[model samples]
Target: MPAFVGAIKINDISGSAVVNIGDVFHIEPRSQTKTFAGAGSFNTGNYLRVKNGYSVTHTVDADNVDNSNIGNT
Candidate 1:
């Protein structure tokens, strides 16, 4: 998981959810610090470093429908 600067809500109803860099998801920011480091990278006191590329995606909907609020209802 990427280093999120703030709190994030990840709703995985199917019990199988994967998140990857470059992949977009609906996020409700609960704090002012919402910045995030790049994939396989991190920031340290104004210094940024990269390691390895780790990315993946989850199946929110098998039918590919816009189910952004799947578990809210």
Candidate 2:
């Protein structure tokens, strides 16, 4: 089926957002990735002693797709 959209209000779209209007057969092409680094704390001014251990890691699953072709005509 189809639809009738009224006057739209202008706002903002995030890094990952989708907007669709009227009828559509399908929608494709979407991706996401997240990565981080270690964080620590330190102070200086006169003398300070501290010991800390903070780490961050990232991993990709074997089932993840990369450099591949999908969908069909």
Candidate 3:
């Protein structure tokens, strides 16, 4: 098993796993990913550090936005 922070609720399909606000997901010393999950809002960031031998799949709520400043701004 792996270590995780924040909440992971069962039957909650519309959310990202293994990430939370102000928390940095470090895949390795040189690489890392961070996520900020806001309430009633969906904020997410996925940094691919390993660059190899890694795979992930998740469902995000439509209400969630990766970031407000990017893409739209």
TM-score of each: 0.19, 0.35, 0.14
* Per-residue lDDT of 60 in model 3: 55
lDDT of the candidates, in the order given: 0.46, 0.59, 0.43
Q: RMSD in Å for candidate 2, one decimal?
A: 10.5
Cα deviation at 40, candidate 2, in Å, is 24
Ranking according to TM-score, highest score first? 2, 1, 3
Model 3 alpha-carbon drift over 4 Å, by segment: 1-56, 70-73
Between candidates 1 and 2, the TM-score winner: 2
Q: lDDT per residue, candidate 2, 1-73, as tens digits? A: 6689889875997766667777888775465454444443335566665666765555545776544434522
Tell me each candidate's RMSD, in Å, in order. Answer: 15.7, 10.5, 18.3
Which model, 2 or 3, shows the larger TM-score?
A: 2
Q: What TM-score does prediction 1 earn?
A: 0.19
Candidate 1 worst ten-residue window by lDDT: 28-37
Superposed by TM-score, candidate 1 places the C-alpha of residue 14 at a distance from the truth, in angstroms, of: 29
